[model samples]
Target: MNTKWWKEAVVYEIYPISFKDSNGDGIGDLRGIISKLDYLQNLGVDVIWMCPIYQSPGQDNGYDISDHYGIKPQFGTMHDFDELLKEAHARGLKIMMDLVLNHTSDQHPWFIESKSSKSSPKRDYYIWRDSKKGLSPNNWESYFGGSVWEPDEKTGQSYLHLYSKYQPDLNWQNEEMIHELYKMIRWWLKKGVDGFRFDAIAHIVKAKGLPDADNPKHLPVVQAYQFFSNLEHVHTLLRKLNEEVLMECDIMTVGETSGLGPEQALEYVGDERHELNMVFQFEHMTLDSPSTGTSRWESRSWTLLELKKIMSRWQTTLHNKGWNANYLGNHDQPRQVSRFGNDTEYRVESAKMLATFFLTLEGTPYIYQGEEIGMTNASFQQIGDYRDIETLNFFELAKTKQMPEDKTMAAIHAKSRDNARTPMQWDASEHAGFSDAEPWIKVNDNYKDINVEAAIQDPDSIYHYYRKLLALRKQHKVIVYGEYKLMLPLDPDLYVYTRTLAEECLLVILNFSHDTIEFEWPDQLAYEARELLIGNYEEVPEERKEGMLLRPYEARVYMF
Candidate 1:
């Protein structure tokens, strides 16, 4: 295995809006993140990947970039950001900014100039086309719902936006625009930033001629990805990006790559490709998502087998070819505990089991904020309480289609982005100690029981479990650089895997169910446990002639 600092480091992704409110203005700012640096350092995370704090119109939760070089006033001033960078580096923690280069908010200067008129100098900076049969230029749909082409009446043309219409896609084919983007990247690097998380990087290059999908009836999540994501031209741009900007510094770069199989992913993150160090793939995250043609809001039951298939493929395929960023929940998805574990009963145990399940794997583990204390989905009652644009758009659409309100609420509860965007529960006090005033989004109702203050006092809480598990990972190179092999692939109730280096091997066994089950050890994996490195329970249960009795949500790591 290669020796890369980024490969060895564990990342903690912070969604800034919901992380901490320093001034009690109901918003998390750079200062709030600054205040939590010690907590994060003590938790043993090496890198902090914060979501976009760049100046925006507050559309799409800061993914819409109105100004590339400016920090959002709501987040804080440039001085605050400089202080944050200095303090984090002082604490030996690297900061990775979320760079949204795929598109810019309509209010952005470049986009505004591009929308001025067809003859404007910056008109070509964005994707624009004449009306097709007096309608949209193409039959594409926005990712957040509705049409991909929002008409620009001033130029008597239509512009492309893969996301919200307020955010227009940049034209990568334009050399001037790419040159400006490179300059902006170099400026940030010179400012002492450690890394970047490129958002929606795959969709930067759309198919030539603005092609239409084969089946327009399919959900935009499915149909549009085929026409717009992970194109060959994306590699061309990324290679240029790497050579012109990234190669000058030793910094981490992870792209948010969607619609990529293992084969396709290699083109972006392969060591020889010079595109990115790693990628955040959506394959495992979509296990509960129905077929491509169906909406993600329309959920279905998923199986352990399906998850294993996706995870195993990525682990093996990227083992030597590239790198992987392992995560279950992020700002865009539902809470991991609620989605994959029994949040109602076995929340803490299952959360720890899951942490062990991923952290012990061969890739770098990423912990989303509030995950350490086993935070759950914010099941807000009314639609008015939700703040995510994606959820609101879907709710509005559902109402128009006469979809039952209860059914719509059910989908929101299960899949809404707001479920993951709730305020971070710092204590059991009012507003979960996130703020002295009302939070922008509602705090999860279970915060009183699952807050960090309570968890820190309990030695066996998920927060401490993460600290212990991460300490073990840092001590053992096998956890980061070893070869991985899935054991008992067909088992529905248990997940077992081994990470092995030449002279060191660690076996991880996890019970993914709520019932007590017996797991028969494979002949090849049979060995007396030498050391119980870490486990959720008090001690390792004895094995019988058949196997060991696995308790509910039990997680055990052993070295032999």
Candidate 2:
């Protein structure tokens, strides 16, 4: 298979609100990101996927966009954004904006106009319906909580919102609205954006004719997502968008798709299809929770088999048909070191092992900010310290349900979105050197040891390991475009795989358990291991008499 530029690219995701605060305003901005471009470049990332910066009420952070053409004043002006883009490209990095077309802020001009009168042309731009049987038009639930249909006091009708009521879902059935979105997209493309990270792209199409979902379980208000997820006509609309805009621009477009299986995911990004360059499927990410409700953080214990199954299925499924965006953590997710590994003890080793597992897979790797230094999740003791809207809503829900205060607090400690939203820690100084002013969120308590300054100066630091991993991917064709084969498939303590191209072959071995384990290679790989490219532990042993042995959490990559 021919390799595309994006196929081997390493993308770094930045949450603009928490990255840096250039002006001592406490909140991060475009100027802050510009100041950090050199940092990202030094970390060896090829692309940067920035979260939403559009004008918004911030009900759902910046996902509730009010305008597509302008940047939010809090983040800075369009001029600042343009400067950031220019600087990034000048440094040989590509930029991708977050495209939030699934919903718009309730304050958007279209929504304000749509909610005015029944005869208004803009009324059809949003999903509005008259009450049935003296109740909501449909039995659908918003993702945040309660009914998805919120009554408009002015029109005496309800409007749909799959998320917060402040974010109303758009009616893709409206041709005019689609055209307007296309024009906005083209406007951004003309500004020289390399691509887009499409937010909630799968929820674009709703059930045709507006039929009620046949949900037998869940509350009456919880069936809203069923009415739209992976709808039949959604692919047609996506193909149209791809042909009209994405394909012509020669840009990389990744979709945030929920409720899509490996097979359907392939259809969205297949070679012959003009839908998307890649899709971020939630199968692996959703393993800890059920589709109907949230999981209790303390009650969850993820097994090795489960993790392997989720990743293996997607890797094998998309290996030949399309591409994938490999990620273990992002702005929305808790730091991988805290959630996936024992951050208290084996922070460095386990972080390196996790990095190996992800970057060695056949996909485009994405590194969230602060991940290279092995940052753990923020520890907020009180609910008052949390700023995420979802966290606050869930805490209120817990209180109203009469749950124990301590238990609720513990749950928040484990699952709060604020864990990932804390300001970046640059050093061990006050506010972790993120800014001269107070940070928007509290820094992790262990910043003294885990901050960037400490890691960058140490040759054996996690930061250095990441640099080595990325350099290998950039320089070796076998690592970038090779076929992936799983080895030691049933070992509970070991995770291993091989990458092979025409003449080069590489073996990746990881010890996932806490205790050391020994492995006797099969006859095919029994020959003396020649080149020990990278290893989380110390140097490889000289002899292969007992095959190979690994210390707890040790990872190794070898070539013969």
Candidate 3:
């Protein structure tokens, strides 16, 4: 509960591939990021979370790193990256790179040497096992689909890949591999990086005595995930890394963990443990998963109660134990306004509501690029318009399974990576003003109405509301380090909470419904309500109000 710079920080995740392209090469680069540092600073962000820029074949969109010490040629030379880091720090913004230690590209030197011969010393750096009865080592499934193990034709063995085949999982059991990773981490820290956003950190360790996942039910993939998620030694390795390198520097460390709960999350980022500063949980992200798995993305069926319960559970649990990284959208997920808000009708109001819901919570907030402008998902006429590797693989898989064309398209529409990979909309010109040439991916059809230039000029725009929310967080101590108390827990339409520190208390009320709703203010702080910090759609009414009235998608922050 003590004060830490990162604990009170507002992080903005920038997918370098989609943020801005300066050279007009159809790809975003580091120089492009340097040109936009002032834009981020004016938005009131403290930390900039950048995706990987390391040398790679881009097999998994740069997640599969080929070199730890060098920058990818396409992104620019190390000199460009150094200048970018220096410029960001000059603007009082910390830069955190995505550290993908969980895996490496198959084209990496280590993997090439490991696969050269059976007796190669580097062979142990990666996981390899003989096929059991001429099949995979176990029934583990890859996140992209098919078996997790890929057969190595040269060695007559199979290597594990929790994701794509090009992304081979590293063997953490190897001491040399751990040391190599630590050396790379220290190298980046020495180069003046603020911290790292660890990718798939939970999967760095695996359950021992590995067995076939229990797939008696029809959920074969879900069962496989349970078998390998949050393995026993994951925390141990994380703590060791923290204690050795990360803790030595005043850097912010966050893990991208998917299957961890509030209780389990504490082990990685609690006050006593010198591990991660926080973690990103996916409970809220999976709210729309259909029971029958028939229509996951196209179905808009999540109730307000479900959304409130999901967020409240994490907020309450993290308040007393660890900390949370509050976010509604990221590079891997769809835009918030598109997924949660009424994109066609009440876009601006709902965008502000979602922003208020996250910023006022008792944790750091991460804003994805274009989120401040209320960006929606792009409309694709055909699947060929998509460039995401996952979408391509899924489409091929669906075809092999003999699923209907419409069914496959529905699945793609629901979970396509292209939803999050579209280029950032800067203006209303051609290509949404993202690039002079064609963008790497398609722009949203509503770009002309929901671009950054238009929002920055409008005081009531979602972008300005986010700026106000961030300013409030910086000016108020209670919001930074305070005790959170959930109010009206059982209310379906109203999501309310209070953050208190000493004599100062701040109340956050959010109406998640499209219709008006009323709530009786809690008596404890009702008499002390003073100023309105940030409100969506309308301001707080005058005093002597028997109960609070909320307009459609209204949200307000009150100081008492």
Q: Which one wins on lDDT? A: 1
List candidate 3 segments past 4 Å from native. Answer: 217-222, 291-300, 538-544
Candidate 1 backbone collisions, by pair: none
lDDT of 2: 0.84
Candidate 1 has its poorest 10 consecutive residues by lDDT at 215-224
Off by over 4 Å in 2: 214-218, 290-299, 539-543
Candidates in descending lDDT order: 1, 3, 2
Tally clashing residue pairs in candidate 2. 2
lDDT of each residue in 1-560, candidate 1, tens digit only: 67899999999999998999999899999999999999999999999999999999988989999999999998999999999999999999999999998899999999889898888899999999988788677778788888888887677899989999988999999999999999999999999999999999999999888877776445433346777888889899999899989999999999999878887889988889999999998988778887753577988888888888899899899898899889989999999999999898899889999999889877778999999999998888999999899999999999899999999999999999988899999999999998899998888889899998998899989999999999998999988998889998999988888888998878888898899988776676555654679999866688664578889999888786
Q: How would the candidate models be sorted by TM-score, starting from the highest? A: 1, 2, 3
Off by over 4 Å in 1: 216-222, 544-546
Span of ten consecutive residues with least summed lDDT in model 3: 291-300
Supply the TM-score for candidate 1: 0.98
lDDT of 2 by residue, 71-108 (tens): 99878999999999999999999999999888899999
lDDT of 2 at 188: 95
